[model samples]
Target: EYGRDNGIRLSAVWLTHDPEYPENLPAAPLVRYGWTPRGELAVVYDRSGKQVRSFTYDDKYRGRMVAHRHTGRPEIRYRYDSDGRVTEQLNPAGLSYTYQYEKDRITIT
Candidate 1:
């Protein structure tokens, strides 16, 4: 919906096999979506076409995303507290910065 609302066109292609794990056997039609004026997003599916994993956009412009992970939970690169303020963020180098918010001030640790 973000893409459609923001006028970003989305196109998809089907692949006969998993590009990341070519040796592991699975049925066909791995759907990959290309965001025009941006980049591509791919989804992995089981033999029944049920979504096994989906690439999630990290921002409104869809310019960045969490890297694809075949196993385990995706890492939390950005975190928000109950009030919706960002509590933590991890950079590409895997370093994490903590955020502290108060009624009138914000602090980073």
Candidate 2:
């Protein structure tokens, strides 16, 4: 992450809650409701810590998400380029969305 408000680096050392003992992580959560072991569920400020992104957790660590909370739920997926840029999104119904980059921003077209 980059800086918070007041142009300070996001590197300020802090304490985080541990479900276990002794192992510590970053405190000062970015979420409002709460956070869990998987990480915060609210909003994510990327490495730049400027633009925010919405995120949710999947039970699996890799591969595709087999099931989700939404029904009629498309099998949403991301196709990444060699550089890891998300190049496409495809749905189960065969509908697709192409992605392109504009400056530092990513948008689905």
Provide the overall lDDT of each model, using Cα atoms, as 2-decimal numbers.
0.54, 0.47
Q: Ten consecutive residues with minimal summed lDDT in candidate 1? A: 1-10
Model 2 lDDT per residue over 21-88, tens place: 66665455442222334443433333334434333444544322222223235546666665556687
**What's the CA RMSD for each of the models?**
10.6, 13.5
Tell me how far the alpha carbon of residue 11 in candidate 1 is from the true structure, in angstroms, after superposition.
12
Tens-digit per-residue lDDT, 1-109, candidate 1:
1113245544333444666888774444344343433554555555455655655455653545534444355544666676666787765556678999889999998
For model 2, the local distance difference test gives 0.47
Candidate 1 runs further than 4 Å off: 1-76
| TM-scores of the candidates in the order shown | 0.33, 0.32
Cα deviation in Å at residue 103, candidate 2? 6.0
**TM-score quality measure for candidate 2:** 0.32
Q: Report the lDDT of model 1 for residue 50.
A: 60
Off by over 4 Å in 2: 1-36, 40-69, 102-109
